[model samples]
Target: MGIVRIGQTEITYDLRRSSTASERRITVTPGHVEVVALTSDDEAEIDAFLTRKRQWLFNALRELETTTAKRAVVLRFMTGSKIPYRGRMARLTVHRHGGPHIEISYRNGFLVDLPSWVGEEDQDAVVSSEIKLWLKRRVRRDVLEIASSYGRRFGLKPRSIRVADMKTGWGACGPAGSILINWTLVFAPKAVLEYVVVHELAHLSVRSHGPDFWMYMAKLMPDFARSKGWLDQNQGSMNADLFTSTRPIIDAT
Candidate 1:
């Protein structure tokens, strides 16, 4: 780790020199900067390389800091914590009773009853797991119903529709007309969830996302853009990570 002044800004960077690295690169994250250079390159060379990338690093760091700050709405699974479902926020109410099963009922948000044996220390994990399962099951049923309804009308039937715990993408259509959707979409608004289902179903007809494909989307759902925009704007809060980490960047040449 070293401190170097890049123009008007003072920058702190963790520099690692690798013999196998073919070229130099810099990574910018919310916390700090990381620079990778050649093992044979001297301090001057590294400094020059960093100087060339000074502006990009500053811009990337500023943008990432702002985004991380705005999206750090990590709400743990606890009573009174507002959780999103079907495009609305629900309040969680929890209770412990004499039973082995985890009972859940949704009046406005959610009401839960856990076994008396469970202690306070285990409440968060237990609640998170049970609610996630409940949401996944509901999402699966809805996905199947929507897929079936759309399939009947569009004449495009999928061999299988599965809900998966995917982290990156929302949904995908594989060979043999199989559609896999991320289970996390259960937290999205119901209309947004339907948009994802119909989107994949359309893929059974059109392979790539060309004009004809969008034409199909428009015919199926006239106002899909609103849902898509909602997902786009709130994708950062889809996960409940409390702290920022350095994600891998596209290596700069």
Candidate 2:
């Protein structure tokens, strides 16, 4: 129902108002700080768990606070702040009510003059939606073209293509011909994104991320190391930016 202090730890929870389940489950996430009840009947067990996890809860809260601060910084960058494009960080130009358009173009060797029709507060949503639409169209087209080329080259064919906002991985292919591409991959560089497509498509033949996977990926992309570096350097920001969804951009795909 509220925060209670056990020794030096402070735990916050909400009492049931219209709960339907009877199990108690605690989740610690950067976007939220609370103990949730899966079932109301397990309140006692929850209390016990809180007692045992008091130190862990406190540490988790501290870590969550840090994560929140980092996300705030990223949101600030996404919202009307200058950010790097390719290798250069450019100032964002916000323009509202021109024609409902968003574009990134170069001026004076800088990426400048984004459509200001969207407000500063709606930048993340606007950018994400635009990029997502862009990605869907681009990814589908590229995946089809790439897969077709590779299918012919390697004698393999992918059954289907799908996009998801996966948190832990860029792309994966299941043995059953299912392929999941992370939506955030759209924010990455063209080369890096292509590498991901090639990587996943390669899995159509070799489902495991082993020597064979590397061998195949290397065959497809000899310079994949650069793409991996791009992902490692930029994934945190990309993942952080994906969750701040408030508005929808027209799907370009």
Candidate 3:
């Protein structure tokens, strides 16, 4: 019975059969809510099942709606906006320079230097790109360092770690040893970033969400709870920044 709903609205789903009955599960992800049916269940039965779980479905959709509304408020880099990078808040200040160089240096705080070669309107784009590139390298280095140290300790090494602008989770590990992390992790604290890395690395040892997985995660990081607390408080803000990236216009001016 493949059926899903967003609040009271029923979502269109393509029903299909699965090999195992236990695999018939419903997932309410930030991307979308989906239901997987394993056997040839009756349409009426499926509808009834969905009806029974309507409250849970409504709640999930409501939460998603709230998240969407909150994310709509973009966190763009203004002249005085305090943006956090690598656990420290950096105040943004624009400087018009003669040379074609967009430099980001910590003076009294984070100063984004924009070349006068670019137009005033284009300053945001230039600054955004420079910040993203700088932060991207920063996050990549930190992830590599943290992942490597843990890999050596836990005897679980990832084939590769990738950082990208993902709208969903902080990090994800596929069946392969490949780890995909959100580059926006640069905006988060060190502990939050490490938690995401550890969470994904643990998937290499335990593929499924079972006792073994939790045990492995605990064995590697004793302060998982604290890490999660930091993530929970910061994840929303981190995710909120992705929306702001679209506001910066990048074009030859």
Q: Which prediction has the highest TM-score against the true structure? A: 1
- Cα RMSD, model 3: 19.2
- Give the distance in Å from residue 151's predicted Cα in candidate 2 to where it truly belongs: 3.0
Per-residue lDDT of 74 in model 2: 31
**Candidate 1 lDDT for residue 128:** 73
> lDDT: which is higher, 1 or 3?
1
Q: lDDT tens string, model 1, 123-242?
A: 767777777778879999999999988888878789999998786889999968899998778778889899999999999888899999999999998999999899999776665243
* Candidate 2 C-alpha lDDT tens digits along 86-168: 33444554433455456654353222334665665456555655544554565566666766777787776777878766778
Q: What overall lDDT goes with each candidate model?
A: 0.79, 0.60, 0.71
Please list the residue runs of candidate 1 whose C-alpha ends up more than 4 Å from where it truly belongs after superposition.
1-76, 240-253
Write down the TM-score of every candidate: 0.65, 0.52, 0.63
Measured with C-alpha atoms, the lDDT of residue 108 in candidate 1 is: 91
- Order of quality (lDDT): 1, 3, 2
User: lDDT per residue, candidate 3, 1-253, as tens digits?
Assistant: 3445655577654454556755455545333445656577677766766676677667766666666566533244558766667666777787777877778877656788777788754555667667778778888999999999998888988889988888788889987799999888887778888988999999998998799988888888988879788888767667535525333211110
Q: What range of 10 consecutive residues in model 3 has the weakest lDDT sum?
A: 244-253
Error of 3 at 16 (Å): 63
lDDT of 3 at 91: 78
